[model samples]
Target: MGTGYEPLEVLKPVADDIWIVDGPEIRFYGMPFSTRMTVVRLSGGGLWIHSPIKLSLALKARIAALGQVKALIAPSVIHYAYLTDWKHAFPEAEAWIAPGVERRAERHGIPLEFDHYLAGANPDWAADFDWLVVRGSKTVAEAVFHHRASRTLILTDLIENFEKDKKPWWMWPILRATGIAAPNGSMPRDMRMTFRGNEDLLREDIERMIDWDPKRVIVAHGRWFEDNGAAELKRAFGWLLDG
Candidate 1:
């Protein structure tokens, strides 16, 4: 029911104005996958929430104490499950989704609306974050972010570092086979195949992320890097970058 990162829905500060919440696990392709969310209080005092999890009254109260939720971001197509609930809670918060998310939601009959499509750095929160849509993946174009203030790189499925001990025995082979096991996780192999002809584009984007020189990296699933962010980026992405 819960991932190793307990104390769900409570804000865990990562840096000034930035915090992360570890949420309950959700099933993906019949496998239980852990979920996490990132919250950032913008300079103007509005909250930016990334990949919201199942909402609760207690969580809502905690968020209200910080600031008004202004932006709810669906960083990838598959990460929009809780957007509708979050939208109902913070109607004023603009919902931003990646390119293919709208269609994915529609197919699943999830009635969700969005105010902006996350392409490049939009003027709305550009002052605080640097972002990019990881090009070359025809199936999943995840929008990755770098918080300028905290020097933290925020990613979704791009890099999953699942700890073996935290996962069930049945998931060990799957994790190792997909190369998403902790201490050495990279992009999943199947996802990598989607970029068959466009490795260069992905490499370019990874290069830019490495250039940002993040201090830490926060991922939606699994263990995130707490320090040496750039080196971790290089190491995690070595499979493609080295080729």
Candidate 2:
């Protein structure tokens, strides 16, 4: 999948102990779309997986190779589609849920035995790192993570990365209208419309993320910036702030 700017393939290690799996190919649906799942190795050898899309036997084997699957983190309610598969593969690993995921899980008949729920501005589980929930977005309670050491920002549906020229015809008008289109090609309009009435919270939350002075920004649907990440974030969220 495109991170809305540059296109990449498979899981690429952008930082030490952090790997990003770009999505855009709905391998099952046979449709082109942008999606991503990030895998991280915690300081203590536990592994954390965020926004995982597909968990095939081969992928699971690969993940097992990285480290023991200590936890499966669903960054948003909508991102839990593959949780069952991942859980089946790693039954011993606990499932961590964001806010409002239980209802969605039940509706989809997806068992959510969430061992932890991210509450308030600071969560105890988050040691040495910080995150915030974009309060106003109707899509889902999206918990964005900012890793201090790597200067990385991990996101879910909050931001998208897809190039207009690269998108199918039906997606163009949607991308242009929402102001997600960037000269760099990430966060096309498909995701911009989802930000309705949540601009202030998003801007505030993102400002908090930037205060950490991140050097890299990893978007689920787009490319990850290796350099000048804060600038890229400012550019990405500028419209929401200005509006």
Candidate 3:
């Protein structure tokens, strides 16, 4: 039997105004998987959190120092593990979720009371952000959000970030075989799966994202991309429209 490799225990800041905290001392069949979290402080007193993992007292204190957390947002149901804890920590703030995530939460036995999510419906919340519901894909009902001021595209599981050279031995095969891992961690497979039968709809969403001209792309499973982020996105998702 093989002794599984240990989980990564480092948190690195990969972009301006962004920090990625990898999981510590954990693994799946010797493959190390890390969770990514992003903290975006919007104009004025608005704060948007994307896929927050566990919030220890120390982590909570670190976050509080940034500013008041105006809203806690989760991109999908699977990413809500720390929502309750963070909501308890920041009870004054509102909770936001993606489409069909609430039902999935209930099924997964996770307690969640989200104030809003894109459920084949429109959002009537804050005005500093715009959200897109990638429709026609029945694989998953979730919405992706873009922040205007920061020009940041917040995503979870929509992209992968494994560095081709740095990936742990076990992960390389799985990621490459799945076509979701690239030299820069591309989600070819998942992106393909995400679009499924709704290729045109996915294209429209990408065009919408292009309109925003975001400066950065944040993914929950991989490194955050900056510096010609739009180009990175074009290269990453190019496989979809091109093929």
Candidate 4:
């Protein structure tokens, strides 16, 4: 099935040297969730892919036209489903994963070979991106990124803005309760619970993202913010930022 942002597997430019590809929806907990991937062409002419979706020959060709695929990012434990396919296609690309992903992949019986664990500074793409691991969550840790050139903040699941019209009627209440409904979506409640005692840490990270002054915010699942990204960050994290 198509995620409203159709023409799947095709590159849709978000800014200079940056593109987002909407992918097919995946079932999670019996609910269908949309997926997206971001592609960035670094200054040195190499492509950096984040939260990759299902790979296709057409998609691969399109991406190759942009630049060589240098890095494949699994930004969160739950977002690495298609990494293996991409890895097979681009044998030379480095697979950089977030914390806990290795264990999660192994548990799911998905054999994945990762080249680097995302943490601290990496000279490879540091010149074009600023990133940080969102700490304090007991369940999951996400590596958030900000593309320096386009001022675009790339997020996996930190904040979801699923549009009501795009989802089934049965998911309306669930989405509202989870606080992920579009135009007002924030961090999901269950994920927020994981940061109970260490909200301060999450708050600090949010502040740092706001400091980036991103012009647009690209989320993996939902309608992303195209403008006033700093304000959107504050609004999305209002639960913690307010307190």
Q: List the residue pairs that clash in candidate 1.
A: none
lDDT of 1 by residue, 120-228 (tens): 5455787888888899998999998899989999998899999987888999999999989999888889899999999999999999999999999998889999999
Q: How many backbone clashes does candidate 1 have?
A: 0
TM-score of 3: 0.82
* Model 3 agreement with the true structure over 191-215: per-residue lDDT tens digits: 4676676788877787777777888
Instruction: Give per-residue CA lDDT, model 4, range 65-139, as digits (tens).
Output: 877899999999989988989988888899999999999998989988778888764858878888999999998
Better of 1 and 4 by lDDT: 4
- Assess each prediction's global lDDT (C-alpha) against the native: 0.90, 0.70, 0.66, 0.91
What C-alpha lDDT does candidate 4 achieve relative to the native structure?
A: 0.91
TM-score of 1: 0.97
Candidate 4 TM-score to native: 0.97
Which residue runs does candidate 4 get wrong by more than 4 Å? Answer: none
- TM for every model, in the order presented, reads 0.97, 0.82, 0.82, 0.97
lDDT winner: 4
Say which prediction, candidate 1 or candidate 3, comes out ahead on lDDT: 1
Models, CA RMSD each: 1.1, 3.7, 4.0, 1.0
